[model samples]
Target: MSSAFRNRRIPTILVALAAISAFCVGCSDSEDESDSTTTTTTRSAEGADALTPFVGTVHFPPVPFAGSDGKNHLVYELSVTNFTSGKTTLDSLQVIDADSGAVIDDLDAAEAHQRLQPAGSRDSADSLEAGESGTIFLHVTLDESVAVPKNVVHKVTTTAEAAPPDLRTSTAEVGPTKIDSRTLPVLSSPLRGERFIAADGCCDASRHTRAILPVNGQTFVAQRYAIDYEQADDQLRIFTGEPTDPKSYFIFGEDVLAAADGTVVGTRNDLPEQVPGTFPSGISLDAADGNYVVLDIGNGFFINYAHMQPGSVRVKLGDKVSTGDVLGLVGNTGNSVAPHLHFHVMDGPSPLASQGLPYLNDKFSITGQVASTADFDRSEGTGIPLVTVPGLQTTEHSDQLVMDQNIVTFG
Candidate 1:
């Protein structure tokens, strides 16, 4: 009986100790035993018979904001470390879902090793120099339909192309789910820096862009004659410089606000702003639409506000914005002759497919004259002759000029 009792007590004590160790010390590798048996097997299979093993890790950044599609997508960043004696290259990467074990994403470096995929699995076709490393990025959508348990396991696999080609794999588990929300401005300044026109033609036909004026008192002109945009960045820009005047130099940098709520789907911020100029020395960055912002407004529709000021952008890379949120001030940044706000709508993420969508100004004042939407384009639209308030205000009829260009010309 004593022996039997001791046997039972031994198992009970071991179980208790294991439980305590798990709770107190946590689970981590405590030994550095080189499993030569496994190593040899893997080496023989990879044909690297002489090459050693390299290990690395992958991580992802948080999502910028929720999309109008009601789906939350996050960008993943992956890093790899090489421990060999020479350099190597990787061809591709793949990510597998933890719950379903399904492949989530894949990335591959293409010709000249330009494109790099996000974390998860990588190709074994590329060579990795000993002690060399690489990184990549990918976009992944979160699964919202499933209920996850405490700790879920995920698997990652990588394939490489090297002197001794072999397959590399890794696995990790995801903890609980958490959602975070933060707010920031959406629109951005138009004038980025000094840029040259990449192509010719109007908005959709050209590859570059232009800027617009946010304040009144700036004079803008149409492309006088289909002129070449080459060497336009070196031209001199005209500005009104008068916050209250309607006839002045162009406004390049002003405060811009968000038109709606949405996450930043795409952004290109490093473009140089074009200098103001006329024929002979035209603006270089001349493109139709000009410097602008494209905001996703849900239901496959994106609103674009173009032709903005330079060096006026305030938002960072990833930020969420609300309606009427300040994005940046308007100015002539791209293929613009004068300062003007160019608005349009598009179907896809690109502005090239954007169609001229009609938008109603919540309220605005017309100081000089009023022109119908149709007649506005003929003579740049007639100016509003009335002072706009909640209701209306009486205006003096002393001004007799045709207020074209939808502006309220003040004298």
Candidate 2:
């Protein structure tokens, strides 16, 4: 296939996550890891901390949010650094409630490796050399019967290749963090329709959840809560004709609505629509969001809408908008690979420099779900019908967040 027509996911880029700080032992770098990249915590003065060879901490204190599955989920990233002088292998990880000493969750080496990824690299994270760092993308779900913990810690077990005979294997309690107590913004749907797909959204999706990037000397996870919304026809078709034409997609020229009451803080409307099917190359950092709108929704939170149709933006800077206001029309613009509405909530107005915030939709229903992200991509690339999972009930959801690969209907 020609390079321009080759299928590539939208907004792909290389990023290096910052090393987390907690149990910094046998430290090599003198600089502090407490910059804007990670959440800073006070180190323990206990004697047992001196024996730990791995440093770890969370990027942000996670807020528990309800999902369409009727479970409370804690979604966040954990960064760890092997501060030992030799190679170290991660054996297991267990999440523990620091206040009650109760174990919340446990993962074996194989499962942990799937969730762990080295900074700026996609290699296996089962082993780490000296000074190597990796981030574990965590998605902990709790049943309605269980109570949410106020604080949590990680019990990490590892083995060092160069350690003395009696000290080769060790376990350490690291990455102490308190749960975020702030309230999540209850959002309205960004579009009103059926067969809407939440692509590259929430929880375990690496395309958005682990998209940590460095900007202006600090690393931030602006896309952590992002969701690319696309629509499909009754036959589960995302596009009917030429894949390269934005007009061929089901969601093309659809109205993009404001998710909340907010004032427009930023606007861009001059960029032309990008051809669908293949990812655009050489997109500058500034134009990656193309023809976008940023809304200041109060309490230091902002709503970002990207990949809008050229000349379709209805709101300008400083214009006050209410829920369900039409901001623009969805189009294949900027760094997009298709015509879809890219929506997210951030702590600041700057798209790339802000931290993502958790949120929930006021009402929606799960009519179905795509079998997987790969299946959705196949339908997008080949113009085949979406591969859906059977036996799923058409369940109604209210005040819950839609997860990745969900086929929802909002009104």
Candidate 3:
């Protein structure tokens, strides 16, 4: 491929993930007696087979996708194991900017998965076996038109098995955005040049809208929530070479601070973390979200935080908080990554009883173009930093909830 085309086309594929915490999807203490030491070959895009590196062995089928730049991309899942025992260190896995060597995640694509890997696998064929078992989630984008490099490092690793943390009492509490203000608050910036409503948990852009926040400010936008499998299971979620290197992928139980302040109205903190996988073997035995919380933000509105670290929650159901408070670090106790905060805003006391509402933050900025359905050309600078992209602002006197209709006045 020409340097220019390769530079322009592929990086968008890298930044598209949303959230990939850590989890232990396929971990086993099985005994392996295979001493053959003979190399096994797997086929590549070019129809050529090669000996497998213990680190990059993949068994899941490839997922076909279309990129924001209008090219076909493929994502895959695989099992990885640490044979040497003790530990292994993964490094040098990166997706670089064609020209400046800068890295960014492929979050600009609306269809991106929070983490790579499909919903299921064929008998866990793609998993790594430590002596017998271990695992990881892999995201890949391939262009048949681009030359197939013989020794290309599609993936890399440095350790045997990364373990999940025991978060018996972790919790996270999200705060409220200013509804009675003219400005729209910062909801999410999945990656640079990528920001959107926290309404639909899915990455579908069609589901995105400026209307997520209400004009009357009487209520907040409705939000969709889902169980993040990786965190729930204790497998590390890694983003491939955008804005950073592949080595940057990580394990779970990292800290997740409170996004807002309020009294804790509800809490569920006794679920054990699961192993990573879409349909984890024993998933049906557990509730969708293992551990969660709902904070009473005064009035009828409550900030719903889900998938918290088990037992790490500092506050009781009635605890009070301020902005930036350390409610709890991230964890894979619920439907989650090894550890990450799954948050949203709703009108009722419980996730099931409340309706998702639009909201704004007290402080923050949007870093991408506010896309409208009328024009596809609106999206630009996927990885570039966006500042002062006009939308809304807040102030002391003009305190009224901003709605979707007001976007025109601000734009």
Candidate 4:
């Protein structure tokens, strides 16, 4: 529950006056009485005249996951739009435990600015203009031992010039509504006997693939647990000799395989690969995903393998593919910075227009990890000695989620 006062008593005289005004408006002869009556009733019931200044929706996976860090993680986003006629300031937003009314997390103005999507960040004004909408990313991690909340609340505060500060709040019921966890296919390394670094995997804070994309007039919160895999040598070098040549990287043209038994639902293999060191200018949405494949792994789950080489896809739509089946060859296409495989699991066949769900791998050996991209880049560009920490020596991960920067080899 929100601490702010939300329900104010309406004076009897004002109610009577409003009713009389509605009656007068209804009797105008040009307007329908039913329309006038319904409008008045709706306004009074919702207190629309005493506007909240903001309106929006929030979404999250129903079943939360205990991530690699051993914490129950909740990833959600709030799409907020200013409804007030004038500019309004969004002071703060908070995630609250509905049952105990405990404040779970609070996002102040500066923190909110940092979480806003790219379009929202472009606004130079401090206040949101009327009808302007923005998205706020919220990631909450709780003790793994604690039970996940069945319901959550969102409390927001905003202010306008003449009106009193409004405390607008909403509640949503959450449960294990997401797809049930299944044993992910023990996907063989797309590149056999070669070590690859997990650039962004599972639930990492710096993983922008987890960001919500507002597409086709719909709020698509997909790619929440996507992974970007790049090949790295023993020295942690991503590229050798010539940096501009795609062939210089070890991952280019590597065989891509099906992670599980599934039917191919979609694929694109006509897009040309971009130059190794530079991103293509003015990339369109359809071309952004690059050459890709969407496989239906049954039970409403779809696996996406993206950035495959042109003219290399061996499977077609509706083709049944088995685990480890050669589907295509990896290439730099779409919105790729270089040659890498972008993999993720979603609920829909439409690659970018679905909800991303968490998945677990059967087994893999963790060899090492790169601390940061800066270190990885320096090692690749300047040949500086890269520091590598020995991981869980040849250990097998059973039904465990992969983490960021993990250099792993599949059994």
Candidate 5:
């Protein structure tokens, strides 16, 4: 899949190619009775009063992520909405390669206008106005000696002064996608030998660790690989005496295990805990995941466990839990700012309405690296050190794939 985007044709005014060939024959007749490995294909071009304007989807991440530097990355997401009542301008988005159509990477219009969303403040309007929705956070690394692009192609393009028709283009078709990785366990380290801090791992352009969450009305971007786990030390200090004492921080209650072998499907113990350096007022999104736990752990995955520890939740809702079993401790409650854990792996059990897949951890080691937690929180408030790196560093990350700040340890 690399013939560099063959025969590019861009011009359309009132598209319908037999309604896009009956929407690709009803997506190949429900993808042959659907077993679901995640494949999606779409293409559109409308204007002459039929109106569509832009409309996008992309997703893709069933496999491909061998990267700890060995390459093969992939990671997708395009979203796009703008449905025309007025403003529209995306004008470029590429990614192609669906069997030799090549192109591989292109999203740039000021980083797609800073990854649009809510579009109400950076002085608004980077185009998408009418219905307004935006995501574009792709990745694509490939080349660990080749052979990974089974299917892909997201090629979008737009422009609209009320559909004047200067360019339309749409493409879609995401993948043969299937990289189901989920080997859990090693979950017993909400903090053990000490220094921790992966603060927003996996694809974090920080829309609060990957955004676009709507839920009931649907929109979903569900954390897309969430991971916040915090606690720091060996000089990369996180907090000490009186920051509203959630035990002055060093990972307040700790524990939190059960990274696999599950069945609990939901539990949310009382909810209170939240003081360490503040933040958590008027919270509600059904308590924004404060004292949580979700588990299921079967094929369609489900392992949530966010901001735990109010009563330290043991396991309930159906109770079957195994691998390192403990299930609860670490706290600062919902939408926290301190005692961290907030792990993720979802497809459902409703932790913010699911969909954040990708899991691996069968082992971990990489011992030193705080690189800059805002220069270790300004060297723990001005003792002035900057890039601390304490000791013990072997970097043993097998079947590895954990991003953001990474300073692992677990067995």
Candidate 6:
């Protein structure tokens, strides 16, 4: 459980208050004075928290890192529960720099609705019923000129006329968490070639970063920092000939390199390749990362290279590998829709259960950017040239996580 979840206390006093609070939402102004309920309460002792209408906790402390956009990003979620007895409408939120008293970001109601998804539904919403839970997806970017904060907190305010007239505009402090300061691993390139596109990658992309799954009774975003690398030719085409043929891809059978020196902890080399053009049907969860390898890259970090060519994995379990060593060849396999390398650094050996962590490429050159995921998909699915943002500078970057849609060259 998150620390914030454990710290919130609602004893008997709040339980009685919750019931009265519910009745008070629909109570008329002419109701007897004796039936009125008090909504505010404060403890007399110093540092004691008073009762509040909502509770929120951050499931994972974000590790701030610089991205290809040349800015520092803090990407994480705030899990919340409505403690009020009446329906609560989220008004707005302000992410504050708890130490410097600086306002980091202000999300209006519409923006909140776009990012806030309820517990069970995939769609986003801005309101929750009494005792309901939801999650707020947040992506905070700090400009290159600004300093990153050591800690951050949220100010959650509900809509006016929500309940208990006096508490209509109440603001509560929630999800205060210390920022993780550990340095992200600087890794060598996992692939070698020009025009290697960083698709469905970090910061705000939906396909990878927003892929949250409930596994073993806990929720995890294993692909939060994952990058699906696909290559394009000089004509900006993902494949030249038959789309179904794995050999048609520019990166097919290319060597997959170890990003860091580490001992092989887990591996699979027998899963057959899936046909390109669409996702395979009915893949079990255990086979999601088909013919893959996991490396313990020291300090509790594991790197996963998934969807490799069947029988191409060169390293076995317990085999020690060094940076730039050949691990396998990229292939279309497992839950994959096409031939691309699915790569990510996780906190655990099991790719599905661990939280994703950020990593920096030791060096790489940016070549271009795909206009959008749709454009890349269309070009990959059909034999069309990829739509790209023109005139991107081909410059080498050092020690930064690549962002979404960027076409890069690796050594």
Tens-place lDDT per residue, model 3, 1-411, is: 434335432222111110011111121442332311111111221122221123334332332333322233322223444332233333223322233323322322121222222223212232233333333333334454542221212323222232222211111111111112222233221111112212222222222211122234322223422212111111111222231221222324544445455788887777665443222345432354567767776655667666665686677778887655656545555543223345655567766544544344333232222233222111111222212235544322121222211111111
| Ranking of candidates on lDDT, top first | 6, 2, 4, 5, 1, 3
Error of 2 at 349 (Å): 0.8
Cα lDDT of model 1 by residue, 59-114, tens digit = 32222223222333443234456543444455444444444555544444452133
Tens digit per residue, CA lDDT, model 4, 58-148:
6553346655455666666666676545566766666766676666668787766565553335232345665577765667667866656
Cα lDDT tens digits, model 6, 1-411, are 544345444333354443445345445573654343343321101122444656899988888999888889998888888876566788788898889978888898898777787787677887887778888888899999988999999877774233445445556677899899898889999999899988888867777787777889988988889999999999988898888998898877878999999999999999999999989999999898888999999987899999999999999999999999999999988999889999999889989998999988889889899999899889888959899998877887999998898999997
Clashing pairs in 6: none
- Candidate 4 lDDT at 147 equals 57
- Models 1 onward score TM values of 0.32, 0.87, 0.34, 0.74, 0.31, 0.86
Estimate the TM-score for candidate 5: 0.31
Off by over 4 Å in 2: 1-47
Model 3, residue 102: C-alpha shift (Å): 46
What TM-score, to 2 decimals, does candidate 4 have?
0.74
lDDT of 5 at 41: 18
For residues 1-411, could you state the per-residue lDDT of candidate 2 as single tens digits?
434234341111000001122324434664564431122111222222234557898878887888878898888878888876677888888888788888788989998888888888755578788778888878888989888999999888777664543345667787999999788888999999999999989877778888888788876888888999999999999999888999999999999999999999999998999989888999998899889999998987898999999999998999999999999999888999999999999999999998888789999999998989899999888789999999999999899999898999998
Which pairs clash (backbone N, Cα, C closer than 3 Å) in model 5?
Answer: 1-100, 2-100, 5-101, 62-179
Model 5 residue 59 CA deviation in Å: 17
Model 5 RMSD to the real structure?
19.7
Q: How does candidate 1 fare on TM-score?
A: 0.32
Per-residue CA lDDT of model 5 for 1-411, tens digit only, reads: 322224232112223332333334334445442332112112332111123466666554544556444466666566667765567776556676667767666766665555544422323235677667766666666677666766665656566555333224333332223333444333333345555666657663354444656668675555766777766666656666777767767777888888778799788889888875557789988777799888887877787878887888988899998778788888888878667787877678887766776666656676666565566455434333336455645577766556666666776
**What is the descending TM-score order?**
2, 6, 4, 3, 1, 5
Backbone clash pairs in model 6 (N, Cα, C under 3 Å; residues 3+ apart or in different chains), count: 0
**Candidate 1, poorest ten consecutive residues by summed lDDT:** 224-233
